[model samples]
Target: MSQGIEAADDLAPEIRQFHEAINSGYAAHPPQPGQTMADRRQVAERVRAPWAAGGPAMARTDELRVGPRGVRIRIHRPVLDRGLPSLLYIHGGGWMLFSLDTHDRLMREYAARAGIAVIGVDYSLSPEAKFPTALEEIVSVIDWLRQDGAGAGLDPSRIAIAGDSAGANMAVAANLLLRRQAKPLLDGMLLNYGAFDHAVTPSHQRYGGDGYMLNSAEMVVFWDAYLRGPADYEDPLAVPLRADLQGLPPAFLAIAGCDILADGNLSMAAALRAAGVPVVANLYEGASHSFLEAVSISPLADRALTESATWLARRLGRTCG
Candidate 1:
């Protein structure tokens, strides 16, 4: 083992505390069983209540029509008074949980550090809304950003797309969809520990059991709840690792070393490079899935976010003070 990984391995105490906090938070109010789609929607809405209350409030929050769904979005403007690049961010919850509110703190930090406008998309959740629903909502939000974000003091042409975990999957898919249509292009993409395939990789098999966090069984449960049927697993939008990655925007991908999804993220980065895309991939030693959310407290999380924002700022051609 390298020194970096070895050092990260020694941070077990902190990682354990982080895990306990997250598990306790979720255990307090687990998702209720849903007998119908409407019931599931109700459950999802209730699950989001805590997230809505957890983070700092953005400069502006509003509801906008993204196709047929009324998508909720929060805009965190740059702390400095100037025109800034915009980011359309998607939150991670394995597709079944989480929303803009859950990721508000991270988004605020990005906006403050990167000097960019951060737009958090409250895309539809799974089981109730299912595969294409979230994708469609995300794409529609991108389209809306291209149209209205400029008037909101952003440079639409300098917009980038970003997300964590399942949201990262949606980000890649939305980018691909836009490319296919030859429509508005994104300046770049940031994918953080996203799951790109339903097919099990070595990491999944190796870490299928507990102790690593995000076990294969939990992944299976999340996938089954998010996808409509078995056939949807083959869809590129659902499993972006299965898609052709050519002609996409430059990408910055971050993977947690101990995450079950680690191999999948590495493979996606390799594939994108093979397809001639500029890709910068980072593997944070000793980190588990969803470590970015701990940035408000963890030193390692703070460092990772700082590096991520620096990469993003470079791609967007903006300098941060």
Candidate 2:
């Protein structure tokens, strides 16, 4: 069985309260007629503003371009280590929404609490950018880090990768691509409540509906917006769970026990283990998908992030204190 927080007898009260609060807010401010995707995105950002506000100070921060896709990335280094280990951090929003601005605080926390550097990739979003595009952009970030991390103030060998939801999928896909090129470009991976393959699973059957922040129906809409066609669903890079796991780096996967995507995380850890990749998997009972967004308020989210960071830090020889 997996270690860390096990699925509890009942949902955590903080998470339950968060669920009720969001449900009530959504009910009170029902969507307007003809609300565009942009509109929904703006609303999501506004609602998340409070949780995403403020964080530990960084010693250095820089914005740079990776390549022609115009993918911009923000690099954050901790005050303690000028040459800190780094991780390419991708944000989660069903691959359609959220960005560096939305996940700024989250990255800062990892940089500070885990004593590592963080590069937050501002890759293009979907219905405009589509699948593979964001994936390609992340691979570009990984390539650039491998080439110029020393110049950019990060330790190359210690550079790992991480993300929540679709962002995590991109991290895994990027690692697979680099591996194929005979350039294994990661020290470790942190996947939090990821959406692996589009197929249904037992966890989906148990927790895939009604106020989990990422219900099964919304996931369908997300996949449709993120992918170009049905064929993209089967692409190993696009699905990640469909890809072979051999030769992958060590991984720390965080599963929200009540999340619809819990089974995906479980399956991925199992596959990695079967392939002989070291894996440390955690199941945070009753935590919602993207609940890491509530780091300041939820003890479970804070603890899970700390533990995942610690696991990766130990593997990469960084400090998780």
Candidate 3:
């Protein structure tokens, strides 16, 4: 075993293999021009996610304008016949990359696992549209759903918001705003290894350097891209840990055991509990950040998603067959 993988003895063997595969890919095709956001995204495209493929058949999608910006969304229906609970899923790309297309297979699997219609929201990315832009887009989508589900085959009254990484950050922040404005309420939230705070945690200091798919340094770049200025870090809409946790939706925080954001996820769950919010926090022992992206191959990832779906199914008053 190489020194790097040996150092990660705490991680499960499969998790170690996952990281090794990532490293092998990087070695074969080292990242060039990886300094900028665009360049990094281009480099990321080379690492294949086999687990994201071969999901159940995809439901038809429709393009709609939630806000005046011609913002679009891709809606997927579970195999269930009747109207189903809806999940507004945000794709994680550190707030700069990935799209509905990039995350389609993963969303389809979630719909199949949870037996619910999934609305893959294509919110604005960062650097160009920072802070409130994406949050405002989320509000518009929720408002549109509340007013007119627009034949999206969803139980409008029962809806949950979910995301991974930066997307989870948005889900947490948007929940607070939606409740405060009384625009529309989210039933629950699904946060998978979310970075809830701007500050560094022990996990960041320990695993932020390398081996993990998501490094602490890369996240610093993501945050800098997502935030317009230093002041944005203190904004509740950006840094949700700084906000009061009262009255937010119940949450399912799926923690990656080796992630830099694990500590933050733990803190968020604890804070929610202290605030009297129902919380289900699970740590996929030995899994690294974004392991869910390998749902096809990672048993741990599949288990985490299935359990999260079960909790969300009950929370939304639905059953996943």
Candidate 4:
């Protein structure tokens, strides 16, 4: 249902180069027939290792278990200052793949740039945990933060939720649940190329293929794995586009122009604005999904990250000095 864009170069030069690097890594480690999920994760780790390396270091870093489920969380603090604002960052791997390690550098970057503590959550994966499981764990993390964050050196009242792809979906879903339950809501949301709806659109038809990094067929597989059945298609928690967008906090959506989920991300921004929530939707032209992972090489990625860090600082009441 989203309109199509026409451009000579589908992706920017740097983004295209980033794709080449990732594609080459996959080509080097071709998938075996009938490979298990563990094996697939191994391949992904190896492919993504280069991108996750060497970013700004944190003044203090710690790993601890939180919530009743004891969800693993890695906290990166830019400084040892107590009561610092926090960003509860959920990593995106379609609820199936990747981990905290895959996104360590990005978390560090945010912490350094925004001068805030970045908490990376290691939520349960899908097909094994299924829908609502990961969502619940995320909500549990939020609850834990609000209740016990000051002990952990964070200002719980200034917390924000952030993620990309499926993680972004869960971020919004968790906030929606909190709002519905009359619980204290997060101060803001930083969503990067989020998959808000399951519906296919013209963008999916155009850019979902080998070069795009995420294809339509792979999305189907991910959706099938995360969801229980047809019933989940109507559930707002599973597909946030179906939810009542009112009463959520200010949001910043980093939309990748050349990605399959572009349309859905755009739709989400529109919905948030319609609900009277302050929204800043930034569309990066010629960018692909997961382009933020290429911050080391892509200027576009760097610019986006800098902009997002600035926005997060403003929304969370921090001065980006």
Which candidate has the highest TM-score of all?
Answer: 4
Worst 10 residues of 1 by lDDT: 1-10
| Per-residue accuracy of model 4 over 1-321 as CA lDDT, tens digit each | 111122226789987787877777777777789999998888888888899999898899999999899999999998999999999999998888999999999999999999999999999998788998998888998999989999998998899999999989988999998987789889999999998899999889888765677889888888999999999989999999889999898999999999999999999999999999999999999898998999999999999999999999998888773
How well does candidate 4 match the true structure in TM-score terms? 0.96
Off by over 4 Å in 2: 1-9, 24-29
- lDDT (Cα, tens digit) per residue for candidate 3, span 295-315: 666788778878998988888
Best by lDDT: 4
Off by over 4 Å in 4: 1-8
lDDT per residue as tens, model 2, 167-280: 889889988888777786588888888888888888887777555667787788889999999899898998999999888888999998888898899999999899999988
TM-score ranking from best to worst?
4, 2, 3, 1
Pairs with steric clashes in candidate 3: none
Worst 10 residues of 4 by lDDT: 1-10
Q: TM per model?
A: 0.86, 0.92, 0.91, 0.96
Q: What tens-digit string does per-residue lDDT give for candidate 1 at 88-169? A: 8998878877667667777877776677788888877777778888888888877777777666666767889899988899
Distance (Å) between predicted and true CA of 226, model 3?
0.7
Question: What's the CA error at residue 258 for candidate 1, in Å?
Answer: 1.0
Model 3 segments more than 4 A misplaced: 1-7, 27-29, 33-36, 80-82
